[model samples]
Target: MEKLAGMLKRSREDWAYCARDIMGVKLDSEQEKILLSVQHEKMTSVTSGTARGKDFVTAVSSLCFLYTTPRFKNGDLISNTKVALTAPTDRQVKDIMMPEIARIHRRMVSKGFGFMAGELQSYGIKTGHEEWFLTGFKADEHNHEAWSGFHAVNTMFAVTEASGVAETIYDAIEGNLQGNSRILLVFNFNRTTGYAAKSQSSSRWKKFRLNSMNAPNVLEKKTVIPGQVDYEWVNDKVSTWCTLIQESDFNEGEGDFRWEGSCYRPNDLFRIKVLGLGPKESADTLIPRYWIELANQRWQEFVKEGFPRHDVLRLGVDVAGMGRDSSCFCPRYADFVDTLKMVHSGGKANHTEIAGITKVTLNTHADKYTGKKAMAFVDTIGEGAAIVPILAEQGMTNVYSCKFSEAATDSGGNPLTDLTGQYEFANLRAYLFWAVRDWLDPSKGSKAMLPPDDDLLQEATEARWKFQSNGKIIIEPKDDIKKRLGRSPDRFDALANTFYPSSQEAVAQDLSGVFF
Candidate 1:
């Protein structure tokens, strides 16, 4: 306790020292009030003692004028506020506030203000947390009811997460504001991290919870609920629960099915988008220009640029029980049915169709004179299992076999280890996993990157399938299409593997010929 007290004292002294520096700069009375308000907030919870502490507090207090005390416009305030408030103890506030602390905080608040103003102009605030509350933005500079109404819900969050109070506080916030109509809740999970708020809970609040309400536009009267909201008023509660589950497990596919960052989500209310192949795309769906773009601007600038793309081949195929969908084909086209006790249906492809796809892959992608590098990725599950190995044997060594299930069995068709660890059939799967997971951070824009084709992009967007608590990317058959598209993303798996092999340890011997 004594040691902690001493540190606090030092912090105060440091503030005072900064205050002295701030006083040296020129400033007027309105600016002084804003600065004081800021200082008061900083000092309210802290002990103000020692010259250093006093000076530090005084300096920050003066800087607050840049926002509220008016003579300085927003631009002038932002430009000089950092210099005015350069107190050593300021860094101790937290990581998020360390960089452009004032700027980001101001931006967050300003953005919040703009958003709320837009809401008011179009619709209006519904009340409750949606009263246009600001979580991490500081309001010490101005006592104006307009800005003050924006509470620091996330400051409490900062205090709570440290004490493992997140679960409890999160529950309280949900309980307190869940049913209120026209109310917006700004839940801040990453406030202290300096990164803009991005988390499962934040995503849920923005996408599922807030969006679910039938609030009017910002120009209209805010929606009002006389009493607590009935639980039934919500749609897709199960989906929200699933989103929370996704966040806890670090599911990566964002935008479309769900998103962690700035990706669009699918609304059954909207029609699906169809992309056609143009000069950049072949009837085979080969995106050569996209590949060249990825290799040039993104990769060559960063990683070993000239890694010889001529050798990389992509194989495309499908996986299913030996059957045909009634919607797409005759049910009688189903060659066989399932023996599984749990309502299983068998799927087998007509040999003629499989031969055709295989022949096309060979002609379009694998000819020696094509001089382009790439492979054909084929789905290796169910009906696909029957033909992938045969393709591999037919000198298509780049034939990537897909095994979607971690509980999948061996060649003898018996369950073995998890799917990610299954190396017995093809080493390519392992290589692909590392390439996506280890090589790239989806947010930072990777250089050694290959943009996914429309099909791959669709799968990547819909891949709501994620790791279980045990850290495995679990993809259930039923939910696979719901999250990954109309079918299991077998083509995506093969392409991902070929482009970003799981490992470069043992190169396929056949690949040596492509180097020439």
Candidate 2:
């Protein structure tokens, strides 16, 4: 009790004391840094990999922010101070964060600490004064009103799972930050945008990324901490969950990147969920800026510098008539794209005429390189379907009608995955775009040299993708893309169609049973 009195003055400035003495927790190095950062900085952002004890520390700091406050004039009890602990969902606050806080409050009360007194309830601790309290609730994307009325003078805002909280809610929280107020955000670091992303990315906030790779246990390859991130677990996740782009998978017609693998999905999830780096930061995107800029630089160098035109192996046609969308023809060499043709018919050409134009365009594109019509892919989903039989009648035997809505296929003409595979495609649209993304990867020895077309770059980079509930990568529908960009992604679509990721055998299998 005497030791507790001596610590009162230091408690206001020292969160480690409050954590160790009052809460009975010995924070790790990362947690200690977080606690001290919250002590001095107005805004502290914590983006963590799996099992880093950030939530535990966040709960501890929130509780400490409440208990360490100086008392009112009438008593040695706090008043007119508030700490708000919020998450994207009520269950998270009620089940995970608030419970930890309640347990700690109960421990402090049981230990006979005389300086602070508050009623410890379910998810709140309130002082005798009506205004003094610590509370937590759901502050999801839609709940702008939830952050309102939290205008306390010595306020502390702590958000858990903050990635799910929307920008409007963050703005509301920002508006309420006044004198002696601070905000702490702790989250899984999943998203690449939104206020949570800004908190990590923007220099305004002091940020910490608690990667599992750097965890003490993971580094030591042992259980240094009983429940912290471990080395073997990380190895398991890397082998089972993450994948690098392998060009031979498409070139050899052996594999398709079906989001998830037979069981292990080797993609960017490992970067966010395990490595804890900011990642290539491609969440919510089809192609990351990292890869897009790579292709752009290639265009400025090899293609823009007037490289020799080689034999064109593939030609892609995205057909649209007098509608808002333009008919785009993308010609891709073995490694780059230099020539492109776009026709905006201005409501003058029908699908039949467009088909005739397509056949002429294909012949022209081929004449530049192979002097014969190359194996071509035409978007035969809508009005473009009329162009298929018209071309077949024109003796265009090399063209394959592309049904964007058809089921995705691998190098071989299978459903999507064999029995051993786990991931599924949303449609052929996603599969083709994914192939374009793979083809444009800078790491590949033969990355695509693209024409530096602005619309192509915008559509290629801005197209969004997300995983379905079953954990399959799904591209945003073209209609949604049009809504966001205010025009159809015709050039990008044509560019995407250039990557028909199938070998000769796969094509033969598709032609045997599939429609032209």
Candidate 3:
């Protein structure tokens, strides 16, 4: 009781908590101090991005046990007492708040007071809808250098052979209201990387197979085309990612952390900080920024291609209504066409029209496309059936309504499915997964895809696959996609489905006068 009273006294005086004892177990003063310091550091100085404090805290927490290491034969009175008081919660210390404890000791040696501020800023109170706000604290970035170094080590170790080190290093890196909620982050972080090596080694990565057990919060949005392991989530906004690009030595004069626009300035350690967390509602605010940047970059790249050199062309349209999702038009057979255009369905009608015009402008060689050009329309899309018929009326003989396979079968008696056929689900899904793998793991880039703005490619990346015990796979959509990803990955899936086997066969078929 005395130890508890003493700890509470210190916690209240030093950490400025409204109350010390919460529920029953004594609130840790040491943990509070470290958390405060971290919070202080974050809002004031830059310390190793936003994840270093957790790393430091965990390291210190592990060392806390050293004080109880049977110092005396019977154990010193004070040491024994400390251990006796804390041992009951030993599991919590080692597993739950290890990082918080580590931050304290690290601060003591580093003489950094900013740690407290950083912790406070990071300490969040959740309102409904997965929204969070820093309670009685402001965001800061004090120990940028130290924090950056910490993140670098943590992220690097996480992706490399030192993943275990990362687990222990950043055990307290979450802002969940309860340990259970926070532990989910840890579990996902660890499990998500189980086959990371395989995913990264390939130039093209298949969607990772995930179950509700592996990720309960995640909602399945859709599956990849075919023959791949890619999946999409419709709504699972509660997620975060932190990575360390490199380590730096402050002796070289580079600070630990620096953010220039969305890109973090490369420190001597080459720290690359990437993190995403917030409510589904707020996703709208940030997603557009990423998309705009991505789309513009893609557009610029497309413009540089000058124009297509192909004399004969094959064009396609997969349109969408201007809802939350953007509408898009993709022109494949172009001379200058590279896989740089950020095309999708569900944007503005203007963008759709613009994309169509851009595709034609970029690919349609005036001299070559005079009479040899060809195009197709999948009537299922928005304005697709209507637009194609109108175009056909205007003498565009290439327009035709899409049809599901009436008589198609694979070698082994498998129904050549309309959903899976035209898209070449097997190869297309595999290719898109490989693209994700290349993005996740660049070193082992063996199975890569050619650069093309295929909706199927994007959809494949968003597709979610589940590998059964027998190795069979399934793809489907989830209701709560907003929680899984900031937005619906349906667009990406739709694009991936474009390359299904049936679609490939359809494309290969000569349509000289089919519409007529």
Best by lDDT: 2
Better of 2 and 3 by lDDT: 2
Point out where model 2 deviates above 4 Å: 74-79, 114-117, 140-145, 243-266, 282-516
TM-scores of the models, in the given order? 0.29, 0.51, 0.34
Question: What local lDDT score does residue 340 receive in model 3, on the 0 to 100 scale?
Answer: 27
What's the lDDT for candidate 2?
Answer: 0.72
Q: Can you write out model 2's per-residue Cα lDDT over 24-61, one digit (the tens) per residue?
A: 66678888999989888999999888888788889888
Per-candidate clash tally: 54, 6, 114
- Write down the lDDT that model 3 would get: 0.30
Superposed Cα deviation of residue 415, candidate 3 (Å): 8.4
Error of 2 at 24 (Å): 0.9
| lDDT at position 195, candidate 2 | 77
Ranking by lDDT: 2, 1, 3
What's the TM for model 3?
0.34
What digit string (tens of lDDT, one per residue) describes model 1 on residues 1-516? 696446334434343322333223322232233233343332111111111112222323422222222222453421211111211122222232233234323343453323211121111112122222212222222223322222322211111111112333333333322111112112212122111121211212221112222222211223232121222322233233223333333422222223234223332221111000112222222122223233234433433443333332344444345443210110000111011111122454554456455555456644454464334444454565666555554555544444444332334444333324542322334334433432343332333344323334444333323444654334333344544244554434543434423232123333434421
Worst 10 residues of 3 by lDDT: 79-88
Candidate 3 lDDT over residue span 107-141, tens digit each:
43354323221232122212221111112111112
For model 3, the superposed segments whose C-alpha errors exceed 4 Å read: 1-316, 322-324, 330-382, 393-447, 450-490, 497-516
